[model samples]
Target chain A: MSDIEIKDNPDIKSELQTPPEPGYSEWRKDENTLYNDGLPEEEKDWFCDARPQKARKSVQVIENFLNWARSQSLWILAFGTGCGAIELRPLVTSRYDISRLGMQPRPTPRQANLIMIGGYVSIKTLKRIVRSYEQMQGPKFVVAVCSCAINGGMYWDSYNTVKRIDEYIPVDVYVTGCMPRPEAVLAGFNKLKELIKAGKAEGQNLYIERFDWYKENQKKVIKDWNMPDYNW
Target chain B: METLYKELKQYFDVDEFSVQKASLAFLRVPKSQLVSLLTHMKDIRGYTHLVMVTCVDYLEQDSFLLTYLLHNYSTHCDLGIQVSISRQNPVMDGIHHLWEQGRVYQRELFEMFGIDFPGSPDVHEPMILEGWQGPPPMRRDFDTKAYSEATYSHRPRDHKEPEEYMKQQLYPED
Candidate 1:
């Protein structure tokens, strides 16, 4: 094609490079979304009226020491969905053997208490992750171990990948690196243990409390969700 | 190679045929004559191995060029058959009966290109990318970069030369 031909041709510029369709904005106008759009009239006032009951303080029990013990021995199910998976192999081996710290990789989500989201969690994988997160029993902690889990690292601009794992499930510790070393992963586990000891890592309870919000976010992206609202 | 090309040309009015360096040859066949030609190549020409089934997008022509690559194990020769179909409505004859493994590649092509193989069983099932809502992403018209921008939110970054930043960190004098 000649210079003038190139200048005049609209095909040179892709439809995507151009702005959205002209009537899209006009059609979307006058449409306001309310919080209780689908809810019954009786349940419309529920959100504003709902208030969490204050926790009653109690004396520490002898069984409460299990929290400290549990912190020391964290069973992790590495959801290695991206490049950060390579770093975790060494964590089990001698060089940066995190298994020595009692941080072991478990196969089943049911048997595991801690979940380490290794790098990018795409929209499809996010559903399974949420189900796995919900399957674990109470007193569970999450350590999001990679930059992708934090804010989508390499796939930050990809449509399918989720930006932040924390938005979907409660993340106790965030190990920041494009692909964090096994040493950094150990540090993150150690940090999570510290939070557990201090009684601050209550991600499980938080997840339960904000279940609706998380489910809304999850269902919005994952079309054709045939599973139950909550796995539990 | 000349005998093979001439035989194909004599039987069917092939659009284009060229013998590449070595025992490799390329043939552009119309979609209508694809199955019969492939069957003839496999049965008579001794090109038994159905190597792979793949497609290329011809954006300028507004069509998809589906290629079936075959190999002859005995002679160690390769033959590629190229067939172009409409981009808007891409439906092609399934060569799965010739080679059972062709079904797998056909399924993938269908998943990525939105092409349909009428006789293939795996065409309707899910492939690598499951529950895909967007257009056939491999198409030239499907702008993935734009899709990424629209679907995903990117952080505004203040980028600096990593070398200069490392120089300051390692050698403060520099």
Candidate 2:
């Protein structure tokens, strides 16, 4: 009975070969690798025609909407990644009253329009920052607080702290100091507000549409298994 | 105009002492007299606050730039005294003996940048990380990305499987 059971077992396979599927290669091409002939003759007329006028009109509307939207709100993601966070507290606290200028810090990236990457962002924290930036809705901005975030003020040589956050994420404002003064941090905040008011704060989606660099960098900064809770 | 600067200049024969337009003064003193210089700054200069003591790692130039950002509530001016030291085996005396706040900044500079501050009460224990074993993590050579991957625990990131969605659309599950 044991010998018969062993011979009858279906788990073992004598040979293995990859299955073949027709039109597999035909469908596998990325946007850039298309073959004109491979497309159906009937549908060929419907494909690849440049709509310059329609494209222009849509661009104009989006440009107008974005310009108007940028002025109304400029949310800051309070990263508070290091000791520089100390100064930021007073800005938001009762003394400085940062909210007077219609500015308040948001904890979650999803709700933030700007990311204040306070102090030196270590590579470990950078991964989280990148993920946060991604989860945030469109029209985002970043501020590198302190000289450390710009070029690693004192921790430049340390293995853990990144010299510049710009290498990992695009920064719209840079406040310089070992840990920048409260006034300097306020200056950066004001600069962000001015940029937003000027209708200059463009969203990352513009770059994401033009080039694949953002997408490639997004993957490189964060490992495939490390990320969770991303928003649509 | 601060008495501490005047006193130190007389006693130490500092190389240069020039006050910038911003009301901040830059005092350049001999490296040997730094300890004495710090002592007088705290005692007589009215520079009571030790804002931060940090080092800039300039590997290409082979120097560690030490900056002491000091503020005097009495005088109401912020002064940043910057000094460059040799990168290899850097050492300096702890000024914790002078300003009480220097203790934390000095120890922080030591742990974060590995600049040895002798007489510091606690310089070896990790402040930002646990069980760190390697060159000072802030040095230009230290790869932060690699260290982060090896050290810290990360949360999961969401990613959609677009191809899988397309396949599911064409072929329904049983």
Candidate 3:
């Protein structure tokens, strides 16, 4: 193309930047139609529709529903207080396959639905437990697994452990036994599942009502790590 | 009590001892000799785990009870060693050196019950509280509810209308 002709024809200059339009010549194919040709029928139908459909299914809503369903499947936070926690292994492991019931064990408090207070908790452990409870997200559950959590069992008189865990955080299920058998823990899980199905199992959110309780406990537990420097 | 009976005969100077329950085994030792007994449990009895070390204030008895919950994981035995000390000066030897994890419990006990462990490192610094100068709240003498009430002032429940207050309105009782 001559410089004078290119200067006169703006379309020619634009065509140099992009490939010439397919419809411009008999040799040219339909580019828009060609690009869209590979799309499936359903997607094409969706794109062609003018008015919005009522309550279109979203990836977010689907994911939210899946998460809600999965949350019902409690993930036990591995915060074992004493020997009673040993039985949890059998329930989680091959013997009972607690996973069949959707009760999986998790290491972190953030991911877990249930924080099982196993056996006797020392004031030290109680501090850690309360901190863990605070860290957990909304819709958390507390399962007190032994007589110790209920009444401190054998360590009731000992200055180390609180007789009842209820003094600090709300407990959902109290599984009674000195060292509760694996079957008993499974029963507790079943009970928790029933509660979940019944809509009775909602995440523990007592801190919203009593904010100072957390502050006092945090001061008592996380002494060195204060709120100013630490991430909650 | 078979193990306690045999262990008492083997270790303790006093063979005669009382059994509290089938599960809970307790042995009372002289306050001065508590360290030696703990050391023996650690070295000889293989009760390697120091589950907890706590001080209970027995104000009526005019004494503080120091209890050590020792566990031998191999034998699955829990031992409770108790030593009664005068409440006036609650001092005992620090057992941090015996069990590695005992330092945590010892430090907490020091702060919570105000029990002075002679050789306990880092006992002065607060375990759970920062800038704490008052008597330990866990101590029987320190009433938490009373302390809280004294420390905090309650806000008025009822609100005054700004329009009424702007005029010559007195604070109403009704």
lDDT of 1 at A167: 62
Please report the candidate that would top TM-score against the real structure: 1
Ranking 1 against 3 by lDDT, winner = 1
lDDT tens digits, residue span A1-232, model 2: 2332112212111111122222323322444333334345675555542211111223666766764555445667788898888888888788787777667788778889888877877656876787688667767788878877876667644555656566456677888887788888888878876775565555464333322333334344333323322213
Instruction: Determine which window of 10 residues in candidate 2 chain A has minimal summed lDDT.
Output: A9-18
Deviating ranges (above 4 Å) for candidate 1: A1-64, B1-3, B15-25, B154-174
The C-alpha RMSD of each candidate to the native structure, in angstroms, is 9.7, 22.5, 23.9
lDDT of 3 at B148: 42
Q: What is the TM-score of model 1 when looking only at chain B?
A: 0.88
- B1-174, model 2: which lDDT tens digit per residue? 465567666688665567775568777665677777666677777777888887889999998878777888976887767677888878877788777777788777777778888878877665654344666777887787566544432212234355556778888672
Model 3 CA deviation exceeding 4 Å by range: A1-68, A205-231, B1-120, B123-174
DockQ category of candidate 3? incorrect
Evaluated with DockQ, which candidate comes out highest?
A: 1
* Decreasing DockQ order of the candidates: 1, 2, 3
Q: What is the lDDT of residue A116 in candidate 2?
A: 82
lDDT of 3 at B108: 87
Native-vs-model 2 lDDT?
0.64
The TM-score ranking, best first, is 1, 3, 2
